[model samples]
Target: MKETPSANKSPPKDDPRIDALIRGYAHLSEQVEVLTEQVKIQKHQVDDLTVDAILAEFHQKQERKTHADSPTPYGRTPPEPAEKEEAPKHLQPEKPHRKRQGLKLAGNIVFYSALVFLIISALFIRTTSNGSPRSLAGFTGMVVLSGSMQAEIPKGSLVIAQQVDPKTLQIGDDITFMANPTTTVTHRIIGIIEDYEDTGQRAFQTQGIMNDEPDAQPVPAVNVVGKVIFHSEVLGQIAGFMGQYWLFILFAAAVVIGLTVILKRIYQKEPKQTAH
Candidate 1:
């Protein structure tokens, strides 16, 4: 008797091509998952940094309040005179020793110099890269003031902007202009309304992606600054932090960079000669 079709059927043999395709698909899926996770992590990090920067800026603008959390300083807050009380004989007061402060002062000076140098270096790099002159050319770096751009350019991020000829700009390009008469704004030029270019001065208007209304009035071309080309979350955070207590931040950063350089030099200079 012949074997029935059902009995004759066996499991299909695995093909090399089919196996390879399956493995490839699995690998691609894993890669996509990993990339997704990395993106999520980076976004979260940027958000946290931005928040910290904003808070730091706010604190700097406001004066420190004297409260339960704040300790009173110096003779500003006079201590109440103690009522007539007997001095404890068991608690003998010891003579105060003169503290050696010169070493610390010297160390602080070196640290401060290093920090200043690092900041200057960073600023120079930024200026050179952004096409801004290093002197007092009325050019300044602006932090992404708001989150209108969101994912493309989040708030609390630093951007280098230089004043430029507005006539050189084209549609769909990002530009910075004054929004109200008082506030400076940075936004993409969605459209350009050509108007009379009287006296070689062209007026341009600006709008934000997240905004419904166009800017109240057109800004003069002179108000247009250089285009933003660079942005960094780290820089934004640092700027925000420094905005609060600039002196403290400057001093701290200098000390950190100075120590780092000194340590690096020491490590590199150590001889690697073999011991007998």
Candidate 2:
């Protein structure tokens, strides 16, 4: 057989087919480069648009915030945050009320003290039907039944006298003494008679202020009761009235106690009512 061209022989260097393959590969590479450049440009454009949108959104938000912070039109202001409210008058503690309560408490103390004093004084004072002077605790209480010392110590006046040494008695001093076994007399000493009848006893020459002459007899120092210290007409009348109507004292005390209780209850309830 004739030897045909070797099946594995190399092609010629200037073969048209090889040239065509190289040209096609070059064109494909050029197309890929253009497509990659277009992709890069599109991505840059998208990034720019996104940044502009974000900036616009931020500006709009800032404008809205500024509008909200600004005062309203026509000099009308925006509503401010609400201030804390004060407590109601009734709910709030009042200094004046506290002071008033203190004053009231003081007044109650004074009132009760006065009432106790009056009761004690009424109990200690003794009244007699014969109007004789009574002695207690070195003091004497005498009711003047006569007008012998009118204006100075009128009738129906109560005289308080203090016991003192007879030797210390002075002229022009008012003294109370026993004129007889049952009769008691209060008079001013005009003179002091010393060593009466040589008995070494002192006597007091007595006379009423309103009388025109001295007493019929000199008052012996032994008969002296006390020296007059205080006198009151109103107290004497009150004492006489109470002696006659002793039930009034009980009624008055009961009334005072009842009123005090009612007042205390009222004061106690007032705060509770005000709180409600």
lDDT of 2 by residue, 156-257 (tens): 887788889999999999999989867888899999999987879999999999999999999998889899999999988876665455566757977998
The 10-residue segment with the lowest total lDDT in model 2: 120-129
Instruction: Please give, for residues 128-242, the per-residue lDDT of candidate 1 as tens digits.
Output: 3344333225455656778776666788776666666677777766676655445557777766655635555666666677778766777677667666667777777776655
Error of 2 at 249 (Å): 1.9
Clashes of each: 3, 0
Pairs of residues clashing in candidate 2: none
- Model 1 pairs in collision: 115-254, 162-226, 163-226
User: How well does model 1 score by local distance difference test?
Assistant: 0.66
Question: Which sections of candidate 1 miss by over 4 Å?
Answer: 1-139, 180-182, 193-197, 257-276
Best by TM-score: 2
